[model samples]
Target: MIPSNKPFFDDTEIEYATASIQSGNIAGDGPFGRKLENKLSDYLECKHALLVNSCTSAIEISLFALGIGPGDEVICPSFGFVSVANAILQCGAKPVFAEIDYETMNLDPAHTEKQITTRTRAIILIHYAGMSCDLVSFSELKEKHGLYLIEDAAQALGSKLQGKALGTFGDSGCFSLHETKNLTCGEGGIFVTNDDNIAQQAEIIREKGTNRSSFLRREVQKYTWVGRGSSYILSDILAAVALAQFEKIEPILSSRTKIAEFYQNAFAPYNYITPPTIPDGCKPNWHLFALRINKLHRDIFLEKLKSKGIGASFHFVPLHSAPYSKTKLKGGNVSLPVTDRVASELIRIPIYPQLSNAEKESVVSSMEEVAEELGLE
Candidate 1:
């Protein structure tokens, strides 16, 4: 069977990681870590970025740094990886689930406004499938409500909205270098922002809630516990691997884009299944190739594709329907029809950087055969 995803790397990645071991700085704070941070800051155009152990840690630190805790509510989309909602819940805050536009698969700002209560402190906007959300509308909502907007750019490495980088639009943004993301460190993440105050607090937050970063930089002689925090820093070896990936990001992004275009061109009979659409002024990373097929036969379609040795699968499950959110975050069976419908029907195809042209042809042929057999073509 064709693999669903494959991480791309060269001998460069191996050498960098090995060098970190030889340098005797396998710890969180090391030269390799600093090198990755500098490159990430430059690429994302953020002032101060801190590498972390995972994207979850990045979001958790951003929440704590922004002082979102008990009695706080963070607005977010109902449809996404549960981690985005998990971060707010981790901070002892409520995750107010908002609906999404099925086409864009992101938070609907209009619905978000209705969901926000007086206790709202922040908004976590995820760029679903690396397609930049309606940031202009989301930003307007943030300003009007005086709420802090946090960008969950986990899937959006090179994505931008109206020329501005996706992650930089909010008070704080988090990026994942997970094996599944556009960028990879195997398992790593980054926290980014231009704001000095938040950035300073984040360093403290990621370092076991101390001023250790300042001490490490020799700005302070001694460091002590200053607030509530945990060890969220990434290891130097991981940073080394991540840095090499960042350096060759252009090629990786181009390859992913090329595959996406190929799929678009081949799937031009778009009515059979809906494909992702990039709105005006947005440049998506094409992290995922999600198609909306007939909702009733979604499973049948998936099984057929799987039988054909195509690594096609379904997209995320709606968080609202999940046991945790149904019981805690939502506190009620709040029926989100759009999220429910999309979750049941969205099919994901292979779009990894190394996906070959021959594989693409085979995938398309298999899908067309499936559609014909189902009498839907």
Candidate 2:
């Protein structure tokens, strides 16, 4: 049976973790964590990178650093994880749900304009399935509206757009290194930005609002209270694990892309399904190989795939459908028709870097069989 996703880690990570433990410095921002942050900066072309315990923490801390609080409105797509909205709520800010573009599954600049008000302070753009949103086009809207852009690049560690990394597009961007993400450290995330002041503030916020990180950097001898903050940092052991995975990032990316291409090629012939597409200016990391099946038969299709041991599944249920968003935010308008439709029909095939060529072929064949059985082909 093909699994949905798996980290492509090997012996390199084991040695790194073991050595870090042996050294007795199994704390935050240790050798491996510092090195990992430096390497991520070089890779993402950002001036500062702060490792955290999760992408949610990264975005939350970013909001805290930006001084966002109650009464502030942050425009974000409603079709993604509830965590996006949750982060804003945690900051005591309102998350104004912006519609998404069906073709790219990213925030729709046109719709985003309709939702903005004087309270709007930021625009959070998610790179769905590791595909970069049209940040350049957002450049105009962003500048005109004076709205800060925050890229939710959790699934887009290796993806780029116009030669720049996805997460580096806005004032600050967040990436997840969760167990499910391409670069896994079991569960971790990072925040990257070019602004020195924001970086310093973020460091303070991530360390329980203290000067510990600065002290660890040897910028000072002792650390103490400096600002408002919380503990949002990644442990050294997790950094060691991520460093080993980072070493093989190239191979993992290549393999995932290959599998994505195979799924696209195999499913291209079907008239009833639509495969994922990459806009000309964007390059996707192919974190998940998703397609649209006939919504009417979507459940049966999921059942068939699972029965065949294919491990196929679906992504986020439309945030509007959730109880909180439905009651508090959706306003009972049921306005996001496309988001509902897409959520119903979407299917995620197995996309781990370790997925064998034969397993990929099997998934393709089984998918075609289910489609044919339901007269979808």
Candidate 3:
């Protein structure tokens, strides 16, 4: 049976990983780790890139670096992964959930504006499925309100908007290199920023609130305890794997895009489901190929896929309506109609660079058969 997600790896990945082991520098920020930092900064075109342990840690550090602490609130979409909100909560801040645009499934700047209050200090924009949200509007909103813009670009390392990289558009951007992501290092992440101040602070925070980075650069005689911080560093072993993946980004992105396009063309004539949408000037990494089907038919459709030896699944449940959020939110229960609707209707198909042409065709064929059987066509 075809799985919903699988990591792609090659001989280069194994070779780099093995070399890292032989180098006897498996610690954090070693040679391979520094290489990854430089490579990612060059590729993302950001002034600074700090490798981290996980995307969750990347978000937490970004929040801490921006001074978003207790009594502050952050605006985020309820339709996204829970990490953004979890990061906010971890920093003793509140996450004010906002509505997402029905088409893009990204934070709607208009709705975001309404969610903002005096306590709101930042806005976390998540580029869902590696597709960018409306960058211009959010940038304007951040400036007008004097709020920090943090990008949860976990799925969008290679995605861009208006020819500019997605992560660079915000004050700080966090990216994941998890096994399931387009870019992988087994488990790792990156923190990016062009602002020198944020970059400096993030370095300290990532190194357990110490000035070790400065000491290493000869900027200081010795490192000392600094402010609030944590050990969010990614090891050289993982960095070695990530470096190999970075070198092959172009091919990985091309392979994924080819599959996505094939699926789009195959589903074009069917009104039974809607394919993924890409707004003008946006180039996605095709991290996920999600389709929208009738809410009523979603369950049976998933079951049919399973019976056909296909592993299909739905995306997130609206965070606002989650049992945990229902109890934690101060404002009783938040209402996000679009997020709720999309959560029930959306289904993600298997997508990975390693998927063969025949496997992709079979996935589409199985979906078509299921739709027909359900009288969706």
Which regions of candidate 2 are displaced past 4 Å?
329-334
In model 3, how large is the Cα lDDT of residue 241? 95
How much does candidate 1 score in TM-score? 0.98
Give the range where candidate 1 is weakest over 10 consecutive residues by summed lDDT: 325-334
TM-score of 3: 0.98
Question: What tens-digit string does per-residue lDDT give for candidate 1 at 46-66?
Answer: 898889998889999889989
Q: How does each model score on lDDT?
A: 0.87, 0.87, 0.91
> Model 2 reaches what TM-score against the true structure?
0.98
Tell how far residue 72 is off in model 3, in angstroms.
0.5
In the range 1-377, model 2's lDDT, one tens digit per residue, is: 78888878788899999999999988888999999999999998999998999999999988999999998999888789777889999999988877888888888889889988999999999999998787877878889999888889998999999888889989889999988898898899999999999899999999999999889878999999999998899999989998898888888889888888888888888898888879677777888887887788888989999999988898778776778776777452348877777788889889988788889889988988887787776
Alpha-carbon shift of residue 1 in model 1 (angstroms): 1.6
